[model samples]
Target: MSSSPTEVSGGGVFQDVHIFSQNVNCNYAHVDYVLENLKDSVDVLFFQEPPWRTIRQTVSIALVESDIVMGAPRYPDWLYMVRPPTDECNPCVIAYVHRCLAHLCPSMQWDIIDHWDIFVLSLFTPKGAVNFLNIYSDNAHTAINLLSQEVNMLPAFIYMGGDFNCHSKVWDPAHTLYPLVAQHLLEFASDVRLEWAHSSNPGLTHTLHNPDLASSVIDLVFMGPLSMLSDLPRLDLNCCGPLDHVPISTLVPISEFEIRISRMVILRKSPEESGFLIDITTGLWALNVEDLFSPDTIEVATSAVAEVFSLAWNAHAKEVVITACSKS
Candidate 1:
């Protein structure tokens, strides 16, 4: 994360938000594909069966790198700043953010709900706020009963995408709809006004079953306010990779912004933090003890000392909204 150009101590402020969804089946081999083809290319990418194992542990915020960051049950030796025990894990999901967008990541505010079969993220953006889930449900529809209950609780910007495994003639011509799942998904979609995106999907989104070739349109993406979806995503079943399930992609229509850069406003700190700054200044002054210094040189040294503290404080400062702006 880089520093801002301007500074305004106590103010709230205002920003490509692209989203891609895929089920990599926990295949580390495909990490390269994500870094090379997606990375910062997409703002929020929901993944199913991500490489990391989901655990009942999460953090309020985390600084992520090129690797995927997950809510852990504690990765044991995994580098972590904070790891709060989460509700569940199992069906792990990782949100891979690009370095450029690191400064504006949702980690600071968004709630990452980890479940064996789903990863729900509630995020606020310039347009509005949204709660999207990356889910993986098996044929038994184990979570179907709780699915609606869980989703019904979301506040706004509702959307769901991932591996539903709901066999249906609607998306796959070769298969018949599972009565139970069809009922669950159809009703849910109707309730949310989420138009499923694979009306014309040629069949499989999962193909690596090998011998029997159990290919079907299990991977799904559903969204509301159709305008958000600029184009229908197609499954790249012919992906030249080692992964089993295909990665779905499409152009999401998000209003771009002209980010106005500014420097940080330095404010007085708490007594404790201020004590450290005073200690630093005292230590520096001690080095030149007994030297007859000019008042101008002393002023310069003082400014330099203040600059160090200012930079440190601004680095961890919270983002505040200064005003609202229009969106496309």
Candidate 2:
């Protein structure tokens, strides 16, 4: 569950962004397990067929006796991003962003495509916002069709993946004839400047209980222009919890920034605090405010007061770096 930088053969280091994608198959326990156990190992998670259930019941003001507060499971370290569900339909796709990426201001792009079966997660970087699409195309290929129509409107997505429920020779060599819808799927991905990102450990991503039926690689991942530097996605055979579809993960390299771990503070009731207060009073009294009549003079006097306080605080305060082992 570590995110340490990996050393390359050429003595270079890669700060990789680990992304995990899976089809939860409407299981809340699976979602809970992933968020709780995989938070440290994964930076972002894209889930399909996510469970949506009532978390609690509340007193209602309308005709109904009570209203149910329904939502997906929430965790402190992960930002759950999903489309708003209606009475007729719940979201089939959801994306979880770890808190480490909070500073990047990750957001869901509902304006681009407002379908319940699809969601677009955007992470703002120095270059611009990088988008990742989570999808769950059913037997009818609803999400895939929507993607085809909205291909021109999509931003360059670094990654797009989920339970595509599609089988073709393009990804699965077992299939003899290419389905027309599969062709549409490939065309849409290509139109958005995306190419198939083959899994490093290639195998059947989907499994069946009946021994007679053959399993296939329905779950898939695609990469866009922005993800050219990313490592190939891999299927985790061990992580799938009682699900037919295996989880796909990838490491994407991104620019890193140092996190500030310390701040200057004047402890209360300490000698430094007393000195800071005394200095602040003395500096305030020394301010030469001749007139309160003019707006410019008032502005100048206010700025001077702020400067006096800041200088006193800086002079008296001590900087401390807080760590996990530090006590209150």
Candidate 3:
């Protein structure tokens, strides 16, 4: 919230850092609630399975008051990076840094399948210069591949976070897959050569939609030489709704950059109130309720409702009003 670095103990050197992750189920109410509570404490917000509406509509509505918005291709079984809107939507994930920290914005690139979206934000300070790498990885195997690629491409200072989706089993710790993942992680840490940068809380960052299943620490925050873990904020498992995963937040120390541009776009009218009113009218007329109850149709209806919220009206609120009107 302060947009200033909090000092952290260092083995070598340290940078300020703050990161949080959530699998927000594209529900406006829930997303709004989380952001309201977390906006002040976190610098960057990462999400998975965000509502599938267009970026212009969803980001504007959800993060309208935030500093920036960015999004990437939807990864099937992994995480996606998105933020409030900036000047416009781009290929890399959307980001919103504090207005004072705009100078940190850097060039970004994405890999095939959009599994990994990386952006380098340069930090200038009296101590030295540092760069933060914002990353969102797929599951375990994909995490190994992505991290390996980054090890070669990344510069010295880096802080990577998102859904890494990897679990540790002490038994076969020497196995190739687990060992390979561990080695790659170690390689990155060694490159930075800071003993205190790594913050691992096993089983604390688990994300699962079903309340019954045990949660695993799949979400992570990995720092390089320039930063040290100052504090591990309480993990929010209760925020996990129908979605099968929880959200995680962390705080680190690094230089702050000045954000040059920030913007928020909103969709106020319902589709009916807008020019494309007939799209909704025709879709409703075509619906047979009896035959339109399949999962596919439900998905379509859900999307349509989201569209209404973006273009025409607040779909969820409208539904409640309509039900009340009918009862009256």
lDDT of 3 by residue, 1-328 (tens): 2233333346433345465656554554555565555444555555544443443433355565644423433322222334433354332233334332334432233321233244444445544455545544455455456655544333444455555555544212222233335444544544433232333333455545477876565555565333443454445565565555556655656643222211111124744345445545655566545556676766566545544433432232222111100111
Q: Score residue 9 of candidate 1 by CA lDDT.
A: 27
Which numbered prediction scores highest in lDDT against the true structure?
2
Judging by lDDT, tell me the better candidate of 1 and 3.
1
Please, what is the TM-score per model? 0.56, 0.71, 0.50
Candidate 1 regions with alpha-carbon error over 4 angstroms: 1-16, 53-89, 99-114, 199-201, 237-240, 254-328
lDDT of each model, Cα atoms only? 0.50, 0.77, 0.44
List ranges where model 3 is wrong by over 4 Å: 1-17, 25-30, 55-94, 103-116, 126-128, 170-179, 192-202, 211-214, 225-229, 232-243, 255-328
Model 1 error, position 110 (Å): 8.0
Model 1, 68: alpha-carbon shift in Å? Answer: 17
- In candidate 2, position 280 carries an lDDT of 96
- List the pairs of residues colliding in candidate 2: none
Residues 71-156, candidate 1: write the lDDT tens digits.
42222211121223255444445554334434343451233333466665534455444445566777677545456544333333
What number of clashing residue pairs does each candidate have, in the order they appear? 15, 0, 34
TM-score head-to-head 1 vs 2, winner = 2
Q: What is the lDDT of residue 248 in candidate 2?
A: 93
Steric clash count of candidate 1: 15
